[model samples]
Structures are given as structure tokens and as C-alpha cells.
Target: MIGFMKKDIAMIKNNLKVLGVLVAFYLIMGLFGEIDMSFILPFMSIAIMISTFSYDELNNWNSYAATFPNGRKNSVKARYLTTVLIILIMTVITIILSLFISYTLNKSIDLEMTFLNMLAMIFGTALVQSFMYPIIFKFGVEKGRIMILVVIFGTVIVGGLFSSVVDLSKILNFLGVFENHWPLVLIVSSIAILYISYLISLRFQLKKEF
Candidate 1:
């Protein structure tokens, strides 16, 4: 298991060079003006995860993965674990870089909102990944890419409709159950979604021959 995990970790890290280029680009933006560094991290993290999926598909990694002792389901789990690890490492790096830049430039920074923003980012990214993973597992990345775009567009359309008809702030008030503990709420919700996605991925992988 350790050997498999190390291989997966190495593969994940190798796949991150594109993300390194993106991070450098964002750092250049930071130098020019104020950019929402928090927002950039989640976007870059998602891009990295998607690129990993792309690489796995292109190389028929799962086919090779099935030859392992634990079979494809464990391999799927390892991939998901690697995705979470990469996102977390990138998030930490982004936060540290953002703080350094903010302080060096004497920019006004709202540290209080950092945890709240991270909560939202983690939940949002997990939601996107939950929707993407099942499609990728079943359809392969080429078709899954199209499904991913559809999901994004559909989400935007749904969000627009909600915005038009619902006062989001008011709705937040209506959902007063989590008023004071929104971070915990988001954390719990993200865990539940992740659990569901994991189950779905397992099912899809089980159905797959290789």
C-alpha cells in the first residue's frame, strides 16, 4: 500500500507542473495589483485535479492500476486521496504566498474571513469534484470533459435562476439552523458529499472491467 501510495503521490506531483505555471502567472498578477488570491487557489486546485484525471485517462492508468493487489477500487480511492492532498498542499501554499504579498505591500487584509473563505472553497470544490468523478469513472475523461462543461453551465443557469427569484441573503437567514456555525455546517456537508462521491466512484469502478 505504501509503495502504491508513493507512486500515486509521485504521479500527482509530476502532473502539477502545469499548475506551477499557473501559480506563477497568478503571482505575476499579484505583483501588478490586488487579485483575490483565495479565489485563485481553489480554481487552480480544481484545474490540477482535472488535469490529473485527464492524464490518467490518456495513459490508461486505471488499466495498469487494476493489476495491483488491491485492484481498481483501491486505485480509485488512491487517486481521490491524492486529489485531496494536492488541493490541501496548494491551498496552504497559496495562503502563505497571499499573506506574504499582502504584508509586504502594506495592503489591507481581512484575516478574519480567511477561514470562512476556505470553508466555502473546500465545499464548492468538493461539490464540483463529486459531480465530475462519477462521470469520469464511467464515461472516461474525453466524454467526461463534455459532461463537466454541461454540469458547469447547468449549475450557472440554476444559480442565475435562484439569484433572480431568491434573495440569497434572505435565504441564508431563513436557513437559520446554521447561522452561527456555518463553517461546521459546510464541513459536515462537504464530508457527506465526499462520502457519496466515493461510493459512486467505487460502484462505477466495480462495473468497469479494467
Candidate 2:
């Protein structure tokens, strides 16, 4: 497992030059411009991880990896572990950056609320990958990428119709009940989603030909 993670990390390191340039440029804009910078953390992680999957496919890495000891299981485990680590690290980095941006924009840091928002962001990001990884595992990246777009389109259509018919404000008002414990809720929900996603991905990988 550790070796698998190391391989993935090495893959990330291979792209550090390009990643650094984009991250630096985005941070500069967030620091000086009027952009809401919270999106960068999840956006960068997802984009990079998806590209890593593309690399694996291009190299036919999985077929070779399956020749190793428990490789199929470990590969899925390592990917999820590495992804969680990336997101957690990025969340910390974003919070630190938020300190400066918040102070710059408002002359104050609402530490509590900022932390809560970060929790929410993690849950949201993890939720997306939970839907994404299983598809990518069952179908190669090329087809999975198209499936993802379709899923996103369907979600937007459903969301639009639901919003048009449902009373969202009242729903939100009802959900205010979880405001105090939302952090715990987010943490538990994220764990459950990741666990379920890992199981589904593992199943697909175990059955996958390559």
C-alpha cells in the first residue's frame, strides 16, 4: 500500500512544475483580486487526481500493478488514501490563505464560520468523487469522463426542476437544526461516502480485466 501511494505521489511530483505555476497564479489573484478563492482547493485536487487516472490508463499501469501482491486492493486503497490526504492538506492551506484574504476583505476573521464552511466544502468535494470514482473504475477514464458530464447534467436538470417546485427556503430553515452539529455531520458523512466509494471502486478494480 505504501509503495502504491508512493507511486501516485511520484506521479504528482512529476507535474509539480505546472501545478505550482497554476496554484501560484490563482493564489495571487485571490490575494489581490475580488475572487472567492475557496473553490481552488477542491478544483485543483480533483483535476490533478483525474489526470493521474488518465496517466495510469495511458501507461496500462493497472494491468501491470495486478501482478504484484494484493495489488488490486492496495491500488484502490492507496488512491483513496492519497486523495483524502491531498484534500485535507489543501483544506489546511486554504484556511491559512483564508486568514489573509478574510482580513484583507473584511478586516476580521470569522474563524468559527470559516471552519464550518471548510467542512462543508470537504463534504461536497468528497461527495462528487464518491459519484465519480466508481464510474471511472468500472469504465476507463475516457468513457468515465463522459459519464461524469452526463451525471452532472442530470443533476443540474433535477436540481432546477426541484428548485422550481420545492420550497427551498423552508427546507433550509428546517435544516438549520443541524447548524450546531454540522461539522460532526459533515465528518461522518464524508467518512461514510469515502468508505462506500472505496468499497465500490475496489469491487470494480477486483473484477476489472486490466
TM-score of each model, paired residue for residue: 0.84, 0.89
Model 1 poorest 10 in a row by lDDT? 1-10
Clashing pairs in 2: none
The per-candidate count of clashes, in order, stands at 0, 0
Which consecutive 10 residues in model 2 have the weakest lDDT in total? 100-109
**Model 1: how far residue 10 lies from native, Å:** 1.7
**Candidates' RMSD to native:** 2.7, 2.2
In angstroms, give how far residue 32 of model 1 lies from its true place: 2.7
lDDT of candidate 2 at residue 11, scale 0 to 100: 91
Best by lDDT: 2
How well is each residue in 65-173 modelled by candidate 1, as lDDT tens digits? 8887877768778767766776677668777877877887778777757778877888888887877888889888899888879888998999999899988998877
- Residue 188, candidate 2: C-alpha displacement in angstroms: 1.2
Segments in model 2 whose C-alpha atoms lie over 4 Å from true places? 101-106, 160-170
- Model 2 lDDT per residue over 1-210, tens place: 999999989898877787677667767887788777677776677877888899999999999999999999999999999889888977887887778666776757778888888998899889888889999998989999898899899999999999999999999999899878999999999999999999999999999985
